[model samples]
Target: MVDRVAARAHETIDRVAAKAGPAVEKLRESASTYREQLHAKADRLGALEEQWIDSARSYVREHPFTSLAVAAVAGMVIAKIFSSSHHR
Candidate 1:
């Protein structure tokens, strides 16, 4: 009787595993697809960032004095914001 019960338990486990196999495979394929999509998006974003950096560099080269003035004003504004936040 004990042997029969053990055999039956093993059969049940095997059946459950067999039923689950396809679902697990589907989930794995979906995860792989999502990973590929995420990687593609990251690559595109990296390229866009590089493009923006190059554009900014070109702008600064064309207008060095304007860029310097903008940088000074931006720095002062940022410093003021931080100083006020610290006081609060």
Candidate 2:
């Protein structure tokens, strides 16, 4: 009886592992696909960011005075926000 019980337990474990193997493989494939997709998206976003930076640099070169005024206004706005938060 003891031998029979141990054999049954071993069979049960083997069956569970067999059933789970395919499911685990499917999950791995899904994760790999998602990883590829995320990498593609990251690459595209990096390209877009580079283009934007290049455009901004060109614009700044073309209009240095406008950029300086914009920067000064942005600085004042940021300072005001920080000062107000501190006061509160």
- On lDDT, the candidate that comes out on top is 2
Regions more than 4 Å wrong, model 1? none
Instruction: Please give the distance, in angstroms, between residue 69's alpha carbon in candidate 2 and its true position after superposition.
Output: 0.7
Model 1 lDDT per residue over 38-82, tens place = 999999999999999999999999999999999999999999999
- In model 2, pairs of residues that clash are none
Worst 10 residues of 1 by lDDT: 19-28
lDDT of 2: 1.00
User: Model 2, 7: alpha-carbon shift in Å?
Assistant: 1.1
lDDT of 2 by residue, 1-88 (tens): 9999999999999999999999999999999999999999999999999999999999999999999999999999999999999998
Please, what is the TM-score per model? Answer: 0.91, 0.93
Question: How many pairs collide in each candidate, listed in order?
Answer: 0, 0
